[model samples]
Target: MTKKKLNFCFKGSRDYIHGTDIFNELKNCFNDSLNYENTMLDLSFHGIAKKKLDIVEDNATDAKVVVKFYDTNDDKKTYYLVENKDDIVCRYDYAENKIVELSKIDLDLGKINLNKDTSYSLIENIVALNKSLLENMFKEAFGKWYFTRLQLKKIPLNYYLIRLEFKSNFNFKLTKTEIFLDNESLGFIYFSLV
Candidate 1:
């Protein structure tokens, strides 16, 4: 089979989605068999997730995260992030089919607005919401995990806002992604990045 790679960004906004929501969406993409029973589509979130450092509290917060996803069964996928010497980063291990936990995420507390009280409240609320969502999905799916893939019908032009399209072979659709500078969400793209 021919292979391809594409990066996904959120449709719009600099805001971050809670880690729980990310995990849930990821679970749906993995567990959904669509109508094709006996097909185990192992899905994983591939991107950069930073763990922020708070020396005073001695705890880490899930900070800015940018991820693209793909089926672990696909051998041609990869993700790269510019590592910061100061902060701890967590990433997915596609080849081994497991999450690589971060030792710690350290950041300059003053640099990120998450240091503000109101902003921190919002972040906490979102994280709570994400956790609830993930728990529900896990219960409903009986702990099964699946990932989404792109089913492209045509070669996309490298023009403005190029999109790779495909149908979801799972029970879930209407997916969302992160928005980054100079990138647009092409709906959904299958395959993986090398």
Candidate 2:
């Protein structure tokens, strides 16, 4: 069998998992796919829910992580990793492995500072009401998959990106991963199943 690469670099609140656990969790998420739709769920929420996620987990670390986010819609599929400091933003290109200096932007304080804390929820809830259900959903879709990149937006946002690079171009499943911003539900990552 050909070798496949499964790499995941989670930023924000979910970065503290043991390397083994992270690998195992990714394996499980891809193995138990047959009965995901029938798993038992018991979930409830009180807000309008700014975002919804199909699967999620709450056992991560608080370390600084670098996530790589690629724009699938782009013809070149340009990957982006934003770094902001002192009101300056720099964008990196994965393919060329360098920063496109022309894309740099300088701001003078108004909104969206990478060093300041802002209050906004990117994801509200993980779709599965419980852990087992979440596990099953992940497995069924990612059992034979690998990752290509981890996309991250501007700094201080408390969220990054995960890019799946599968083993082959065969039957695959589409799913979402729950992301958070400092213990609060932030948003969902719709995994590309290609």
Candidate 3:
């Protein structure tokens, strides 16, 4: 297997882990395909979430994290990750490895930030997130695709983006994550899924 170079470095703090859990508890929001070592997760629980995710914001000693997200449409699937900040957003496309600076509109700040909370659990949140949420969201977005200009042709693909909030703690790792549409006109699709 080809090795992937992770950009972020360790913050150099001792972690406090308990129980028989084999994995350490610091992480960011990402697809299951992101199986990297030296990562942590802050599991937040609420709503129709699928799979366990690390709370992405306001937790790590240094406010920084490596986050990953994915999108699949018909024959193609793309995965992305970014080392980001609340004030700035960037995305790395897996196919191109190109970094794109994201604007405020690309991220639905008004809707996602308000719903998610501050605190999180280390384990319960992961388990609480279920598959139904994914199916429901995709189901809702499929029918309501907004027509958009794609490659000089009008295509209806609901582009999505995920935001991560990492904690500013020394040892405890937490990541808060939320997904938003590329365009606000598609906002209904998200709530429709929920």
* Candidate with the greatest lDDT versus the true structure: 1
RMSD of 2: 21.2
Candidate 2 lDDT for residue 107: 23
Give stretches of model 2 more than 4 Å off: 1-135, 138-142, 148-153, 157-172, 184-194
lDDT tens digits by residue: candidate 2, 1-194: 11222333332333222222232333344444313222211111111111111222221132121222222332221111111122212222221111111111222211111222222222211111111222333456544322222222211223432111112222444333333344433333333333
Per-residue lDDT of candidate 3, residues 1-194 (tens digit): 11222222221121211110111232222324443332222221122211222333333332122222222322322222222332212222121101111211112222221122213231212112211222222343443221110010111222333232211212212212232333322111111211
- Candidate 3 lDDT at 28 equals 27
Model 3 CA lDDT for position 116: 29
TM-score of each: 0.21, 0.21, 0.17
Models sorted by TM-score, best on top: 1, 2, 3
Candidate 1 regions with alpha-carbon error over 4 angstroms: 1-81, 87-120, 137-194
User: Model 1, residue 25: what's the lDDT?
Assistant: 41
True lDDT of residue 93, candidate 2? 21
